[model samples]
Target chain A: MTNTTHLIRDARILGGERADILLRGGRIEAIGPGLAADGAQVVDAAGAVALPGLVDLHTHLREPGREDAETVATGSRSAAMGGYTAVFAMANTDPVADTAGVVEQVWRLGREAGHCDVHPVGAVTRGLGGEHLAELGAMADSAAGVRVFSDDGMCVSDALLMRRALEYVKAFDGVVAQHAQEPRLTEGAQMNEGVVSDRLGLAGWPAVAEEAVIARDCLLAEHVGSRLHICHVSTKGSVQIIRWAKSRGCDVTAEVTPHHLLLTDDLAESYDPIYKVNPPLRTAEDVEALREGLADGTIDVVATDHAPHPSEAKETEWCHAAMGMLGLETALSVVQHTMVDTGLLDWAGVARRMSETPARIGRLTGQGRPLAVGEPANVTLYDTSAERVVDAAAMASKSMNSPFNGMTLPGRVAATFLRGVPTVLDGKIQ
Target chain B: MRHLLSAGDLTLDEATLVLDTAKELAQVGGRSVKKLPTLRGRTVVNLFYEDSTRTRISFEAAAKRMSADVINFSAKGSSVSKGESLKDTALTLQAMGADGVVIRHSASGAAHRLAEWVDGAVVNAGDGTHEHPTQALLDAYTIRERMGRLDGLRVAVVGDIRHSRVARSNVLLLNTLGAEVTLVAPPTLLPVSVRTWPCSVSYDLDEVLPKSDVVMMLRVQAERMNAAFFPTAREYSRRYGLDGDRFARMPDHAIVMHPGPMIRGMEISAEVADSPRSTIVEQVANGVSVRMAVLYLLLSGSGSGTGN
Candidate 1:
């Protein structure tokens, strides 16, 4: 926390009325029309939209193992640059964050980096092997205070095990973020199982594969009377299932990735591995449905499944390539382009989906707070009118696997303040 | 055409041009000197990541007949098995100044991926169940030769449509050439989205055989039985196999086609394969001409786009 007061002048608060916000003592000191700077460092944030700093519920900071791909420091820098103040780092890492020691190390690395808050999500299965449960209670009890447990890269396919996990996390008020893909059904799935995969001769990932697991997990969560969070809902059927699960009064929350909102399976026609992802990009109908689901509040949050892999991992044949795309740096822009510009969502809705709900879902107290007085000074000023072509090399993440490369997207994060300190300013990492 | 990576990539004009060029080139096989100077001094590399003696020999014969210097790089006992990536292998081929590369690999989209790395034209001989544009071209050529046309002809592509690159290419190429293609196979052997394809599908081979002007039998791998693609070879043969009775039911002018090394008495009986109506031998002979036309078009500037 910095004592140096900062005054953000004339910024639209959540795309609403313009106001000046004062930051002091790690909290919003004041917010009103024409507030005086009072000898503080003044920032000219004219025409930018100010909202609560974004919080990502799903991010892969490949630390303690695959550091060549990403470290907690690099990924934290990436999150902050993407207007994120807090991000829950997933547990599918080397040595796996199933143990308290691993989770604590990741949490400590976040603290040392100080770019953004990193809450380590515990593993649901030991080593994510899908057999025995990890020490979720111990991880929640540890200094990291993990509130999200997931086997995000791999689905927790075992029904009894999924039920037990959903029930087990309840003791600590934790949520199991399921990856939601049936392993056997998606054994050799390379892309969406439809016209494109058929034409390209790549293996198909059926929508039922995801929907079946989601349907089962929703029932499991309901039966166990525990909170279930679905990760990266990619299909229309999945949206319907999740919507049904929600209407049934199942305590469930779901997140849609930024990539899924804008991209589709047609990209796989290029045979480019950059567009290849798990629960692979679906059809245009699925994209529209996902957009509608997010717009209608059926989808709870927009999490950047910011999976980064080494260039070599993605620079190969589509089948031989790894399944993921860099998301953190381009998440906000994609949200703006697909949702805000398309009139499906407004700035406030963007805040709710990208920040508030994600922080609430992860149980983070300081993040996703309103841009008002007496709240934690985690704020992001986004230039919504600005647009630039996405360059993978220009991104902060260690990997260059952004699917949005060369595509122009609206809204650049001008500044991101984590607890009154600027982790990113003037669209550059501070 | 810079690369004949997928039959779907071909337009009607391009597909027709390949067939016409092959028809003219077929005359060379009957000449005193079975050679064309169209691709002389050009280097063609046959990169086989999978063992395909037949395909390798066909491409080699085509390139050699065109007077193009040919280099056969079999993946076996080569740097490919030593864990060298496809990109590295492509770079090595690029370094050797290959003017056109005919690739056969066990991974779908390997040819597409190779096209991205190397500057040479990529002719996908067979890329795991993805595509075999040359094979489709040859099949198309043989059909046009035997039936005198491709338009409005009923071609029944039978067996293992899910795992047959030949079936995929032929379905696409035949469809592009204005032929009506019916994919005949068990539900387990067909793609989930086969209904979306520009072709009809059937579960019963006997029903399709009577209507088809050309019946193409695909080689079903015996290993697929272990995964329960079918109950047993005998059971599969009992239902889907083409024997004398089944072949007799076809239209009198209808020809039998197979992208061979066919499993005798399995997908097709020996009697049917040996029948005069069988274009199996001519298909192989026509393969050389079709491939020659493909290499000539992709390598020479006569085609719309020169190979990069």
Candidate 2:
């Protein structure tokens, strides 16, 4: 093994003391004033803050199904590069992760790669069919130990089925992450239902379609007495529903993607598939509301929901292209831009939303831990001020499908420690 | 610059220039001996992948009227019937030494790809469910000719906007020309994202008729009605259709318009189609002149002139 005598010098240590962290044997040995290390390899943390490794609650590693898009190994590396210590991979693989065997396979692959922990999300139903329940307990007991369940690619449209799915996961405390789109309202849906769709002559995916589902699910969650997590909460109307639900003391949490906070449906005027995502990019007003929701904790976490696809799949016509974009590698930069750059969130807030709150929600133990003595050294050291235009080729994920390509973004990941092991160094996946 | 993809691609400045150029060409048509040498050294190909009569002939006339060498490429009873690909047809057109290509495909955005891949100027005659820029320009030209201007005019576009490419191009160009447009269609016919468009929208045509300086009725295309956007043809015509009774509510100077092949009993009544105020026929005659303007502005190589 390499010499592990590493010293971080002159840093505004995020956990508060004017300290130097000395590392050895893949663990933080000590951190205090004037911690001298003669044989230490030096790292200049000059003006940077040391935060815990970021983690994502939703990411799609389109492997074992559409490997031409993304794989668990590649996705894990992407998470690490993004300074994420762990990611909950969604359960919408080609065969669908409804069973224990498939999820365990994904888990095993993540372990083999060893970049970051890949917690495979189990499907709510067999093949996500929405008719019969899958082996939820078996998956929860499996090696993956999936705590999150979802039928993400399709909405669990049937009211009774949605209620049943929410109730079924109560024993495991698993969140039935609903896609929350009414299929009938959104059939042939191309973009946000507004004046732009009328002008563009494209079909509308209405705000109501998403709002209705989230409203119904929140009440169902209250009735079922189970936790529910709504994926990619995009609208102001949705925020109102979640806000009301929380006020009523219903156990529900919501997430908004980085794209939702930054980009709007106006970008669709170009008809670029890169901007074509599910719960399609909304208006600027929605962007503002979503950002406020995140900052105020109405929206609890910033999940990537990083769906990836091959170039060929996205290169077709707008109506015909695959729905998704690469977000894992760009999530941190987007968060930094939307929150920290705007001064809406400080570094600690970024840590809480991206790491701490997500960890709490996903029930990812040993994660989102503060940088303290005797704690697992899951840390992310970042250059919060450096800038780079993201190139898709440089992403660790297999699919080069990010919309943030050629986008100049501030903040860069310097290093990420997963279980005290440097899984990434200076933005390169280890 | 390479794809003439649609008349919608033309800015107001460009459309005005094209219209002015068309005025000169219309004067040439007025002469007993009608000809031009501007396109003598160029080649123009009309590639119609779908059914055509007016659009095809207008191009043949416009190209021949400009003295350009012309080729008519029809997909009917040809390899396209045998399911020849668009890329294959594009390659075939490239082989024929054509400098200008006018394509009318049933598929929308086909022209967009054609423009990207081809070396010559690609004009969108029409694609499946997209901007028919020339049809819109012609409609605009016919209005501007009779009304003397486009700015501040209240124009209502009524019919199946979800499937109509004509509606797409018109809203963009009309707004650009400083005309206020209100689209009147059932919620099914109107796209979900209509809120983003720059025009006012209404369900009732009678409500808009009093304010409109021009009421342009689009042809009700029956073959394109596939997923049941409206419950019945009669109901769609009843709520959103331009009939004589509905026409009675229009301003005294407000003109009725249709981009031909009108459904006499469906979208508009026979009385409204033949009304003295209806400029439906004027639109057909203006089509050749306006298309000539597009060909001239796009082909004449800085051959700038004034007729406006």
Docking class of 2: acceptable
Residue-wise C-alpha lDDT for candidate 2, range B148-229, written one tens digit per residue: 9999999999987777888888988899889999999878777766777889999888788999999989887775455677
Alpha-carbon lDDT, every model: 0.92, 0.83
How would you encode candidate 2's per-residue C-alpha lDDT over A286-364 as one tens digit per residue? 9999998888889998999899888767654576678888898888889889988897888778888888888888888
Tens-place lDDT digits, model 1, residues A1-430: 3445899998999999999999988899999988898987898898699999999999999998999999999999999999999999999999999999999999999999999999999999999999999999999999999999999999999999998989988888999999988998888889998888887888889999999999999998898899999999999999999999999999999999999999999988778899999979999999999999999999999998999999889878889999998899999999999999999999999999999999999998899888889999999999998989999999899999999999988889999998989998899999
Please report, as a residue range, the 10-residue window in candidate 2 chain B with the lowest summed lDDT: B299-308
Each model's TM-score for chain A is: 0.99, 0.96
